[model samples]
Target: MRLSQPRVHPLTNDLTPEQAEVLAPLGQGGVIPAGPVLNIFRTLAHAPQALKAFLTWGNYILSKKNDLPAREREIVILRTGFLCRSGYEWTQHVEIGLRCGLTPDEIQMLKAGPDAGWSPADAALVRATDELHADQFISNETWTQLLTHFSQKQAMDVVFTAGQYTQVSMILNTFGVQLDPGQTLDPDLRVG
Candidate 1:
């Protein structure tokens, strides 16, 4: 974790009318959603307009609209989250990754990166993510490898997914977002 406490605390249950209006769309019957609202959403509610815009892009990335399949997208997301050391992003995505068909071993391999005994196709995705993280551009070799298993649109989505999660990791880290209740931080996700 980057900070001892949240830089921006979660929203209180009592909200002003304007604040309620801003957050209404995220909930049902004009009431805040039940259960523990994610700290990310709660913190972001402070800037309702920006949060609204963010949800649009976030939905696209998480939705079937992205050319990558759910599992493949999760690969990019989990790897990006690991590389960026965003515990919040990683923990949240772990559950999503499982639902997307990533096994426990596969999830563990993500921490070992592109060379962690993955199939060529899966490895290529992780390699591309690493290249983008390290150089902000994929090398010709990785591009060629990616072309073997992905359509041009799917290949582009690999980059987009990684980029999106990288940005998300930055937000979660910089904002000092904490894990929600019952969500434990991964032992490996240590900040320097």
Candidate 2:
């Protein structure tokens, strides 16, 4: 798939200052700064209740503060990004995925789907999400294998997380979300 590379404006403290402050602790290194979304958020003046709900759900999945492990959460997100071909989603998460312990190879394997020599459990999780995203449901065999390793709660989390990232993938792709200026793209993500 051809990835869209949008042009980003120069880094500025001019955008959504609040969101920038929030993202600071995430260690962005001033490379890929937050873009126009912040201005939209700020223009709303206060957190739109709808956007707040979305943020809450996203925060839960991204941090897995809801209880799923970090590695598992990244796996769901990275797979979703690749399946949807969301360059913004894939680029953003690849950095976090590495921090969460997913090697570049494992993240790349996500493009190969679940059968790329990953462990049975990891493979099952990837395949389950890919199938669910594309087909809106998973095969029974994949479901059973998923149940074998992850608890019902985790299974649910994975499903929700995949759906969440899929939504993000659509938005980023549709809106032409650009990688922040000077932000490093994931070296492992092949550009075409």
Each model's lDDT comes to 0.86, 0.69
Error of 1 at 60 (Å): 0.4
Backbone clashes under 3 angstroms, per model: 0, 0
TM-scores, all candidates, are 0.91, 0.74
TM-score of 2: 0.74
What is the per-residue lDDT of model 2 for residues 14-68, given as tens digits with 9 covering 90 to 100? 5365545443333333322434443222322233454456666776776645456
lDDT for predicted candidate 2 compared with the true structure: 0.69
- Provide the clash count, candidate 2: 0
Which candidate number has the best TM-score? 1
Model 1, span 76-114: residue lDDT tens: 999999999899999988988997899999999999989
Which 10-residue window of candidate 1 scores lowest in summed lDDT?
27-36
Question: Which lDDT value does model 2 have at 22?
Answer: 45
Candidate 2 local Cα displacement, residue 27, angstroms:
8.2
Give candidate 1's error at residue 122 in angstroms: 0.2
